[model samples]
Target: MVEPIGGASTGALVPPDDYFDVIKHICKKYDILLILDEVMTGMGRTGAMYAYEHWNIKADIIALSKGLTSGYFPVGAILTTDEIVDDMMEKGGFAHGHTLAGNPMGCAVALEVYNVIEDEGLVENSAKMGKLLIQGLNKLAKRYSIIGQVRGKGLLTAIEIVKPGTKKDIFPPEMDVNHLIADWAFKDGLILYPRRPINGLRGDHILIAPPLISDKAVIEELLELLDKTLARSMFMLG
Candidate 1:
């Protein structure tokens, strides 16, 4: 399974330009099943209705949740090709179901969520605002030497915090720079998702996922708040 935008596992990491294309080629060559874990990057999170759409990837199966019901209701879904499902059905059953499987309310909410995304032009907004997000984060990176890298696709983005003047060098893990940055920002009312890019063991980065409905003005205010947090972080490092 793969996260098209890498999600929290790799700190909103976007694969290289050729990575997905190459993977698709390899999967086709070997007749391998290509599955995508789109729980975080789906439902218009990665500037597209589905992150795989960015690469025109043909996935055998795709997992989705979170954005499906916009958190108004709990729901999850799996999308697979007819070939796969038909084969499973013919072989008896997949035996994969939940107690609330196909619950009416959850399904209804998920459908409305998609409609809202379209009506609000959130997908388009994500693509436009996403560029601003990356640009804003890059500016902060330029000012804060501790910021090692800034990356993401659409609103699903993050910054890798590093020891200043060292190429991708991590600080003492006890310092917990990721959480420190997030905590600092939280005090100012800007919530950030902190994660260890290196498998929860080490490495510091914070995921910044602005709401799809966010406007430029809101994003600018967010960046201003983040500026303050980074300054505090710099002081702590010093």
Candidate 2:
């Protein structure tokens, strides 16, 4: 089956050239089709027109959602290379589609959203802000052992929480440290997304994804709220 192996959200990209190299290596070795999910990381969320552009790898197919209408409307789009399209057509259009596949209203809104991202320079702004956020988050990680890993590209990033004393002893099931921090951040006026697993036993991640319109001031505010919430949440110790 085909799946995306390497991608980034809005975050630091000091050496984007190297990151793409790893993605290329994996694609070659596995002989798998690279499907780029540009939902949160697309349409300038990464300061690039598309997150994959930063990696400089051409994707066989790209699934886009979320930012298409800038959250004003729900929409999705699929892009594929000419060869893939030809093959799919030869196979009877690939036999898949959604109810609103060609809804005019959604299309209109998505069109405008694309226009705005390009016209307002939001993509470039996201890239710049991503660097700032990565730097700040890295500092926070250094100060707090609760943080296990910080990685992302553009505006899409996640902070992994673990036990305070032992890196391997991640917060226990009863504690749900990811939810605790998410709740804490919400109470502090910074909304964050907590990753959830189907079994409710293996998920532990906090996603930091803000609107593309956010500026440095807003990003700083979010960072402060996140850092403070993480510091105060006691779930990690339990």
Candidate 3:
């Protein structure tokens, strides 16, 4: 089992270039079932409709949620190959002992949601805006010494924080440091997701995922607000 792209646990940590390729090769060699947890990286969040597409690999099982309903309704789904389904059916047909198994309302919402995502080209938008976001952050990193690293894909992205000229040297946790920029941005009407990815103790970073439909202008405004927020945080930390 894998996360494809590490989600909240690692703050959207994307693995090395060949990580998935290597995994797929190993799985094929060993004839092992590959499972992907796409709860956070699926449904166009990672710009490609599915993060696995970035590696062009196939998995035996894929779990999806969150974006499946776009927060309009609480729903989730699982996808698997016909081979697996046929095997399961032969072994007594499996059991579906959970609620919402086939709720017509949820099915309808999911259908409409899928159509909207396709019809509106939100997947392409996420890819487009994601590139703009990364480019903007790379430029901002040049100005802010506190921004140690910028990473992530599509609408799911994050920035690592560090003290000047040092890698992984974060501000004292007691200062509520990781969240300072988030708070500053909030006051300026922008929301940022702050997280402590290093053992959930000392390390600090902020996840920034704009709406899938955000345009270039919205991203520019976001970058400007983020610039101001970083400036305030640097001053306060210094």
Candidate 4:
């Protein structure tokens, strides 16, 4: 079973420590293989080398990409225990191949990326900047009627846009309020992830994942732009 630490598509984050404890225990008891998909949350983006490390749970397998080469080169990796490798070898090797399977250039670039992350302490920077981001977003939530929930972990965060004065009163799909806010932000020189309807429902959310190297000043500037954008969107929607 594969589970993502912070769901990139949905913009929802699973609680780190306790939640994984139960999952790890259940999977162990049932002799199930636990696979962690860290493609989005890996390589110091989530304030750690891997988000799963925050839970201290060992997965049977892990998938990694994107941050592997810091987007300089396309590369991905799958990791598993030695036991699994031995079993696969006995069964005539694992069945998987891609055009870039053994690209030496990609591997070399990925290694350099790792060195940069470690040498510059990007993981710690992510944690610090993430806190600033959450604080700023929460303040915006209090000030803006269109803002609903503000939630996320590390640098992965989300804000749900809804009708004013209602907890879960999502705007109708046709309104596309989330998209409007994103467009306004973009025009103001801030690029955010595209809006998404929650669980195919009317509720809309936008994800905010700044680069791991971002600082508190940059996050504050982002909040300022977002605040202006939301105000404009709310007036237009109303």
Candidate with the larger lDDT of 1 and 2: 1
Please provide, for model 3 over 1-238, each residue's C-alpha lDDT reduced to its tens digit, 9 standing for 90 to 100: 9988878778778899899889988999999999999999999998988899988789899998888988788888889999999999999886766765778888889889899999999999999999999999999998888988998999899898888557568787777677877988999989999998666676588999888889999999999999999988878875
Q: What is the lDDT of residue 86 in candidate 1?
A: 97
Best lDDT among the predictions, by candidate number: 1
Cα RMSD of all models vs. native, in order, equals: 1.2, 3.8, 1.3, 1.8
Candidate 3: residue 37 lDDT (0-100): 96
- lDDT for every model? 0.91, 0.73, 0.88, 0.82
CA error at residue 209 for candidate 4, angstroms:
0.5
Per-residue lDDT value at 223 in model 4: 90
Clashing pairs in 4: none
**Superior candidate under TM-score, 1 versus 2:** 1
**Which residue pairs clash in candidate 3?**
none
- Model 4: what TM-score? 0.92
Model 4 is weakest, by summed lDDT over 10 consecutive residues, at: 1-10
How would you encode candidate 2's per-residue C-alpha lDDT over 1-238 as one tens digit per residue? 2222223322222344576578778988988787777666678776687777765688888888878888888788888899988988998987876777878999999999878888888988888888888788889888787877786777767777777656556666887777778887888888887774526755466777677888999889988887788778744353
**lDDT tens digits, residue span 51-117, model 1:** 9988867899999999999978989999999999999999997887778899999999999999999
TM-score of 1: 0.96
Over 102-194, each residue of candidate 4 has an lDDT whose tens digit, in order, gives 799989998999999999999999888888898999998988877788877778888888788786787888777777788889999999875
Q: How does residue 49 of candidate 4 score in lDDT?
A: 86
TM-score order of candidates, best first?
A: 1, 3, 4, 2
Error of 1 at 2 (Å): 0.8
